[model samples]
Target: MGTLSPAAPPTTPERTKSRLLEAVKDCDCATAQALADKLGVTVPAIRRHLQDLQDAGQLEVRTEKPGGRGRPQHVYVLTEAGEATFPKAYATLCVDVLDQVERLFGDGAVLRVMDARRLEFQGVLASRLAGHSDLGRKLTALAAVLCEYGYAARAYQENGQWYLTQRNCPAPAVAKAFPQLCQAELTLYRDLLELPVSREARLSCGAAECRYKVG
Candidate 1:
């Protein structure tokens, strides 16, 4: 069976901040104890972490009761600023990709090449997700790993294929305009993930570089 491992754990406080922010982005509220339990850390450790995060304005805490509860409990939620941190890694990745593209394709041709690369990337992801029984679970796993590498990915089903869309690119303004750049990214995706290794199989980008579907 093919299995994937999750991204490595955060190694620094700043990375921890980003992870915490991403974890709570969709959760309306979470308790310190609940967070500690989820993260597998001691309650005191979670309290200290939350205090530091709150001081940095990455999170806000308030006490509230949900009617059946005996007393109000403090719940932690991400601030607008906290949510902003989740995309910071992506912005960094874009800079690195754009710099390399400029070196290889000239500044003028970089964006075009990169956009095309992005489409090929989508095809690689589609190929990986093709035979999975639980598309959403597989995508969530894939996106989580991608998020760690500086791309905010979201995947959903379209027709019989899974479509993975990138909301933010480190080279956003350029990546949005050039399809070739996206195509180049697809090449990197193929190489990095060990995809399309078969002699008879070929990966190609489609009509829209922003979207890619594999057969």
Candidate 2:
């Protein structure tokens, strides 16, 4: 006879972890108590799965004050990696299906799909800037937007130019991450007559006010 089929693996652990992650994604963030409450499990059970996910580097655990709490409560947030596992797959499936449908439906459908995706990412920066004025506002706006772009951006002002310190670059993540995204940001100030603009930057991160010169 052929070798017996390998025993089916138990899915309890995976199910528990998936449910816990789903709780965080659905809630955006969750504490053990919250997850337990959501999943109708004990706090200890939820904590165990949370620890496992954190250990696996799929979740970021943070502490938050729960008002009457003696100290703080541990809150679990799904790391990008964790969300990537399932939600992204579903999204890819949807997009692939839609593309096939568009092929038969209309040619402009594909262009519309691309335009919508672009607008969704583009809106991130615009929403972050909401309302502000002048250079500080500009720096704050730029930092906020760049952070969304996955760059750990910080700004400092000195002399006349606002220097942006990029702790992380998102370019390599995107085939054409548009390095010019920065230049485009700088150009936003060209027409604003608040103060003369200067692109001359001197690298400094250790000074009291790290030299990010903005006039």
Candidate 3:
């Protein structure tokens, strides 16, 4: 988002749109004005690109409560598909190791390895989220850490229940190759949050996002 040279209007819409998407994802520019400033483009031009991205299902808007008067503020965030536009940093080497695990040992040994990884992550998450006694606060803290871990996670409330959704999986190949990793991941969340966390959707099952509900 630093001093990006602006492209001329509509002529280079694709290039401009690509830059705009990067601004939204990396710079967290939720507003048209902010995106314009970051990309060195006009507000109206930015708005057009924003609409195009939204129509393509790459981004979604959330209308937050108004701070003062007037209408609520609309903020845009990347959808799972949008997150897919970026490069994934998962190590294929891990997948190779996991495959060897299944070959040399048995299915039980593979589950044990994934479980061990889950336990380590559980300890890290629990320690960071320890001070948040309330369920909502704990969920929010969990989201922050998940994002840091490249999960692109969000925490929100619906129907008086807290939810966690991850748009990106750090180890997509590992998850796809071994169902045990997915199960271990669910177990980690339940154990760390100390609640009966139920999975509503899973990326492994062809869902765009992986969703969990706190009960």
Whole-model lDDT per candidate: 0.61, 0.63, 0.86
Stretches of candidate 2 above 4 Å error?
Answer: 1-11, 66-71, 89-215
Model 1 C-alpha lDDT per residue in residues 36-121, reported as the tens digit of each score? 66666778877888899889888898888856477888988888877777545764576567677678878776756555656666
lDDT of 2 by residue, 1-215 (tens): 78998998866988888877878988744877888999988888888888889898899988887665677877788788887767335445555565685778786665555555555655665556557666677677767776777767788766765665555543322212222333433444443323555544322212222123356
What lDDT score goes with residue 205 in model 2? Answer: 18
- Candidate 3's residue-wise lDDT over 117-176, tens digit each? 898988898889978999888899999999999999999999898899999987777788
Alpha-carbon deviation at 189 in model 1, angstroms: 42
Listed per candidate, the RMSD to the true structure in angstroms reads: 18.5, 12.2, 14.3
Off by over 4 Å in 3: 1-91
- Which 10-residue span in candidate 3 carries the lowest summed lDDT? 64-73
Q: Please give the lDDT score at residue 118 for candidate 2.
A: 51
Error of 2 at 167 (Å): 33
What are the clash counts of all predictions, listed in order?
A: 24, 9, 0
Choose the strongest candidate by lDDT: 3
Give the Cα-based TM-score of candidate 3 against the true structure.
0.58
Q: Rank by TM-score, descending?
A: 3, 2, 1
